[model samples]
Target: MSATGNRAAREFRAEIREWLRAGLTGEYAALRGRGGPGREHEAYPERLAWERHMAAAGWTCIGWPEEYGGRGATLEQQVAFHEEYALADAPARVNHIGEQLLGPTLIAFGTPEQHERFLPPIVAVEELWCQGYSEPDAGSDLSGVRTRAALDGGEWVVNGQKVWTSLAHEADWCFVVARTEPGSVRHAGLSYLLVPMHQPGVEVRPIVQLTGTSEFNEVFFDGARTAAGHVVGAPGDGWRIAMATLGFERGVSTLGQQVGFRRELDALMALARSNGAIGDPLIRDRLVRAWIGLEAMRATALRTMDGVAAGAPGPEASIGKIFWATWHRALGELAMDVRGAASTLTGPGHDLDDWQRLYLFSRSDTIYAGSNEIQRNIIAERVLGLPREPRP
Candidate 1:
């Protein structure tokens, strides 16, 4: 790093650390270590208030430009912000889709008017957002999306279903991928449309999980309407725009996620020690391996951030996805085994305890956000220059 860049990073780290140290007190003290992954249902109202408080303090969307109501922090500084937030055990952000994915996509592709209309609310945490890309059949094969939209009377009418949509019930708007051309197939004829979530003809049903929480949802859009201008980029450009948004998903915020992983691994280690599981050589080996794997994950994530800092990340982001997902799934299993026979029992209503919830949710990590099979295909074809997978 340049001397100036180094100084800026140090200052940024110190600023965030000091801010979190002071801010996480009194009303916010109870929120420590709550609201993440399987536990997102925790502290709904308090978390929202905390996010708005963050917005008021200019702590939201620090990577966005100043004109867009963001601090436009440098990449190193963005990393610092996430690191500090995780180290402080801040609440899992409820607006990640809006801030990390959609906001950047809009800045890169949305028209000037779209920016003026959408960016401010995101900055202020006034409107939450959810991703509309995944569907029952199109989850991994995004090009197969069957959600159809037709323009009529200056409005785009949408009809289709999206499944595994995180935070859909809470989102005010969804960036949807729908077919705009009737006969077009694969990557063609698709439009990325911004649709309102609370309007008529839109339905969101929470998908209850083994954890007894409904973080994922099934959303049906029946003749939902949005302004004709709500499309990002031109018609038939959804594929490119959507790919860019996926690239943004593997950005600096991933470092924050890794911090959470480190915490989970540490907690598991503590549990093993307290319960005398550490006396078993096999369990001891697994704990050491988990720690080493986490360290490797952090290093790899940092290297990936360098690519993201230069431009839109390439298919190589799949490497991080595969590594972290596998590592976390193994960690969850380790959590169960470390608990011995006690892991099978739950308190009342068959409700999942913390370890049980982690195990169940981690099973989906390799499936969602592009499945492991699809990620491998992307890496093989795009990164290794291998032959494309044949289509029937």
Candidate 2:
């Protein structure tokens, strides 16, 4: 370590790394660790067990408040925990969206009653939550969501469909946005609602992916009624609340994937060196570029996380997301180049299909949480002080 290196950071890493090396050693080798997001059965007992163990140890959410199922660790410590988990190859926490997005959002904008009811379960991984932001015509443009919720019999009757709801079919509940007033502006009419999954009027159908797996689903609400108490924040306030959650989606809480990219880059280097693919300058050059991309992503993500913790809302978060998404595509291309035909071949367990599936999944990252093109627009107009482009 350098003389100027932060001692607190080093100490935190040491403590977490020791526990991880001991806890993640054997019998759980099937654990993907920081291998990035993968398809797993919803309500998988084993995955839930691992998450419970982490929560019990106060590691599941390092930065969450102590009263709300967290360690109340420093932001620096939180980053250290994420890095250590990735380095130790521990399985990713099962209910990341609940912990990452919903938890933070509720902490910021939820009422005391709502927090007391939902926060604990979210930390315990007992209640899985899916986002219901994107509607049929609203993927990247979240403000265009047209799902309607009306007041009826002292309850909110939601009648609309949500597409691209990740794992909603398996979730115990969902945090959804619905339009409450027809004449209000796009962002002003929205309200956030929490609806249970086992209701009579709700329908969920899985959408299978190219990897021959089903994870995300389409959710339909046919006069699905929810109590007034389930409403988050206030009517016409969901836009601001959703933006809070989206900040987390693009901030420190979502940096796990970037860490996983490090392990992948390492694995690629080993594969190239050991398999004699390094003999060709073409292969070597691609490997170098891939490694550089991973490093760039880590640096940018870490910096943006620090800014987020400091309460500075910076546009740089989009940089990491965009860069990492592109890196995934580039690595997939390189992986295919290295393995020639095996890269395209989908085989059983632990094959190149993992990379291929990740590649396909990365194709969605740019489109979700606002598309990369939209992010570029924001950077040009909002960040770089450029003139706004007129919308026809």
List model 2 lDDT by residue over 13-125, tens digit each.
89999877776656554564432344555235666777777777766767788887787877777778777777676775668789888988888788899899999988877
TM-score of each: 0.98, 0.91
Off by over 4 Å in 1: none
TM-score: which candidate is best? 1
> What is residue 377's positional error in candidate 1, in angstroms?
0.5
**Any residue pairs clashing in model 1, and if so which?**
none
Clashing pairs in 2: 33-90
